[model samples]
Target: MDCTRSYWNGRKAVHRRTMMKGAGYCDSDIKTKPHIGVANTYMEGSPGTAHLRTLVEKIKQGIWAAGGIPVEFGVPATCGNVANGAEELKYEQAARDIVAASIEFVAKVHRFDGLVTVASCDNIIAGCYLAMARLNIPTLCVTGGSMTAGIYKGQKMVQAQLDVAVLGGESEEVLLELEEHVCPSFGACPSMGTANTMQMTGEIINFVVPGTGTLPSTDNLKLRRSKEAGEMIVEMTKADRKPSDLITRETLMNAIAFAMATAASTNIVLHLIAIANELGIKITLDDFDHYASKLPCIVGVIPSGPYTVVDFHYAGGALTVMKMIESQIYTNVPTMDGRTWKELLANVEAKSSDIIRTLADPLFKEPGLKILKGNLSPTGSIVRPTGVPAEMKQFSGKARVFSSDLDSFAAIERGEIVAGDVIVIRYEGCVGAPGMTELMVTTDALIAHGLHKSVGLISDARFSGFNYGAIVGHVTPEAAKGGLIALIEEGDIISVDTVQGTINLDVPENIIAERRKKWVCPPPKVKTGLLALYAKNCRTADEGGAMQPWLDDETN
Candidate 1:
């Protein structure tokens, strides 16, 4: 029986049927067809979601053709580019939970038999996954594919390059040309940034159609796939195939293995953990490290390599990458369309070996991402080992601490930061900054100043996927909670060895203990608002930084 029947089939549901008629639905349309919720994260003027309305129209057509009713609802979707480097960045991570809760509220209230989430960008896609797991309904996601690469002065460009160029003090004409051309289309940034990473993560975990993750946003095939997703949701609902049926522990391990092979954004670690939590599965940094050790980084997508995700798409996308690493991942797990991964990838092959290399001839035999633990980060910290410059991978430097990203950025612009320095940005974790804003602005400034290879950055906050260099982020037990990062003084020595998976403070144990004894926790930045609530209750970085109330229960 259809879940919507509870609201429309009974005589007591006369008010509901009357409400549906007012909305232009016939009694038969309400009673005979299953209702599918289309949770759209489309907002005007946002590059990632501007074209989603067109996809939604096609999805509705497919739903109607399949004898199902499609109901579209709007959810919050924000751009990190707009929020970067400002106080507004604090809201970026919080928007993920807001999007998830909004979808859950709408789907539960309307009694949808199945759900189809339409989203682009980082937080929106992660939020959709969380909602799917929480609701445990037959659900499918439609990814808004990557934008086309921009052309500037006969060179291909992306958002990350533009960010650094803007701070590099280029001539007005050059800056204007780059600003106008860096984002030539309305879709996610044309790299393996958080947006594209999470999109592919969905497909790897079997929450999306097989090839939809890497299609260009303007590709006609994307529209066709969106329609197909609608039809699939109806079939999935009929079969009672929920997210729980497909996303087992082994399936999640496959997702992580794919992330490792592709050198995906470190932000994926937080998202996968959060998705697992919603399904009552326990995932930690150890799970990511386990895959990172076994899977070779094969895809040469920026900022880990020279090519863009557009190249990855043309070179066979997610399917080819999965084929390359099939031996390392689970192959018998079921996908959204009822085929095991082994069956889905039977005839796939990489079109370009340079873009998606085979496991035997991979881009980097070293791991893609690593979890570093030491006195500084008692829980753990994250770094993309594949992205770091070889010269800076295992260096010791003096500590140059800052309380905020803007302060460090200003110091970089003033030539205060130099070689052999570990720039520490603290008080910016989930409970500290109350949102754990990305540190791309400061990292971009370092690149603009030509210090990306000379200096290193460590933070309790997060970093953008476009960021590279000797950078470590997501330091646990954040400064607000008296982490070791808050106790460092200027000129104190700190060592980071990405190759060995360790980050340490050279100071003695007695001195460190004394400093911690004197350390004072700062008050919440926001006094009363959603951020204040988030600051008071959100989990630490290692625990996915989720804001759910149940997760806060120590006994649970």
Candidate 2:
């Protein structure tokens, strides 16, 4: 059972064990055991990863019992809610590359036989996968699981509602009640937001243990599964089941299809493409549109419906959704457990059709996603078609432009935005904002002001999973680079047709060309720092905004 690499054994073992003894490792522990690195993204600041400290001991016990030496390391963890707006938001995307680089460095330098990444947030999980793809090691991820929904006076409440309530200026008593019970315990927010979406993304790609992605953090099952994951990592190492062996283009597409079916998150498009980029796999916006075009939104969680991820877990988790869409997925694709996807999902069936709907009668008759392209987005833009009212889905309105998110929020607060306006928030794309922050603040503000149904918001930025209404995001070839959005002037007519899948500036071609001649790039938002580096080197949103190692032009 010696899974130790050559550098950790024989003559080199003397040097390694001599160093390990100071750390309290015995001679036997270093010589015969598999050296497994457990990268923990635990921080006390956020509920998403705060409880992972409790899981570490259980994981270590399991690793020891399974004959492996577990060595734990810490990584930075940021909460999406905490980083929602302001200067901190810019670092959110950059942190993914940081985590990937950290993991890769530690795994390579320590020469671990296997890796088990502990994460629950969106970027952390995406970073773990990217690191795994780069290292090609026997790797598995342990999601900290979702929080249980909070109950306030017989009504089930989650984080999103609390955000809306506070932003909408609810009564002080109601705000106090929500502050006391909105988050019941330690875990990611209970909705299918980016955290849960990334967890499901990892699970469907076979990077996590089956059925463990949506388990509630406080549940006894989640703790048990955390330990089980530690054991699974050891087994995977023994069998030489590397990440490259399981992660393929077919598997990535399978994960995308699952996301579409579940109405997971629009952010999955960015994360999945970034992960695929690490493996040199080209997964474009067109590929996402292709899968989303056919897959109906079957599961309803959070902003999409009244349920939470806890409900999805009780309704048979990812396995149930996979079973429902078995025809679309690569059911025979390889998984970390050495079994095909079909075999793993063989026994799973939906226990509650209310949460996970039947394929025949889905939450949305068409796909949950719509990718639009025209003058507004020459590359593309994304729209979650489900839950958008019939009247709001297709509309043409005069353009109301804002150069920044703060400006847009101020306009909404000042009562300048009207019902028949297309609120344009530009200069906030990957290169523009230097981080592409979520427009949830403005989106929620509009909803609070009773304009969610009437007004349409289009952005070069992105949205949180909880965002709803006639919102279109990820407008590519962004304004900072003189894309179509930069040419848009106040009072210009704009048209958006979800049915035809197009978002266009209704201006004549000659006028658009004339306007483009006067467009100029904005100054860098962050003149120096990690975010500045990211903004300088990052690709467009359509390409997943993955930070390039070198400029593409240099390679050319």
Candidate 3:
């Protein structure tokens, strides 16, 4: 309505008008129309983002058709799979801040009417969601869809954490064969890892249009969805519907419900907290237990079950899952379509009962997520209890200490790590590692070493969504922050009871107190640049490792 606020008369407008003219935009095209920002996180060398460059064009076409001028821009995305095994992986979490800042800068300085945030994977989507909340603009999201399952020896082979984790002990012959076939397409990992998990979370939270998350990138349906999202943002702008309108306390709870019901990534827990922090919701890790305890794990997809995200999409995507759990969701909550959740799910149903299981016959007996508190993680810790057997849920073992994932992985390869030991990887938290690196490789390595069932791993780090076993992570206050995890020593009896939701380091209370007094925080691994800045700003994993203050609890 007031498009000239950003252009047409003043000195700032003169510069904007000149730029538009230099780009060959006609007066009619540049005047009196809503200017929508298409913030695309498209990059080469990463399968997750490679296709987005082409997909953005379709979005632009839809914007033009809906009487909006599409202003396209770039955002950075890290391919966690491609950057695996190097120091580069340590900066992955830091990139989330970068992605959010870039989008916020463009939207604020340019004064766009609405925004369309597009990306795949954890940090990228989380960053965009944060930007949307920070800007509080008429906004929508389009996820780069899931990769199709690869066919290996007539069996469906998906690119999953299980595939990566097992590489540690695989024979050379098997490794050679897997390198070519594990991920043969350009999309996020086929399994329900962080990318797919975040995408589905976006849908559940109503940040994106329903049912658009898990479509295969190669499918024409994904293109149509992107185009539709572009069109929808223009309508959203017209109706004055903003991101803050859709992402609310109820919607955020609904997102947690989806994550739990699907047995989604533990990483989702971190991202969700970061997002809620941006909205000034002050969501804590303990808040998650309420939703997790109530919601049943329904969808049996990857890491947790036999199927991949493709199967989940075909079985009815996020809307279908929401429908099955409608009784649990706040149905009065609004969605991107400017309708209530009840309106959106009025006709939604699961296509197949087998893939998307019902509450009556749920996939997991307990909630997928477990928030534990004990001497080891008095601040708290997180673990995925789904897919973990009853015996592994409650166990006690001697601690086998390792300072980092690489050290533990090397020990496993050298046959030094054995069953019945609780692996402790410390100094890898948000502040400790500075980026809080994914522990998928280490978890995979242990599984490959044939000790996943017998051994348990605890860390101040995180696990990939593909990870399964008695592994517990996100322990806080982390080693660098003077948490008790840093005080743990070799052969100390470590107990983890997932059923009871407690993880403790069995030691004398006086000894632990003495250790806390004498313990000195390690020097920042990264002394300068973004990592150092992030180390200074980031809160604990229990608070979602959020750099923002609103997400943090000072009392803890």
Tell me, by TM-score, which candidate is best. Answer: 1
Worst 10 residues of 1 by lDDT: 1-10
Worst 10-residue lDDT window for candidate 2 reads: 546-555
lDDT of 1 at 294: 85
Who is ahead in lDDT, 2 or 3?
2
Cα deviation of 536 in candidate 1 (Å)?
Answer: 1.8
Q: Write the per-residue lDDT of candidate 3 for residues 279-348, one digit (tens) a residue.
A: 7677777777887678778888887788888777887888888888888889998887778989988878
Model with the higher TM-score, candidate 1 or 3 = 1
**Per-prediction TM-score:** 0.98, 0.96, 0.96
- Of the pair 1 and 2, which is ahead by TM-score? 1
**lDDT of the structure predicted as candidate 2:** 0.83
Residue-level lDDT of model 2, residues 15-48, one tens digit each, is 7778888888887778778989999999998888
Order the candidates by lDDT, highest first: 1, 2, 3
Q: What is the Cα-based lDDT of residue 235 in candidate 1?
A: 86
- Angstrom error of the Cα, residue 13, model 3: value is 1.5
Q: Give stretches of model 2 more than 4 Å off.
A: 1-4, 10-15, 550-556
Off by over 4 Å in 1: 1-4, 552-555
Lowest lDDT 10-mer window, candidate 3? 160-169
Colliding residue pairs in candidate 1:
none
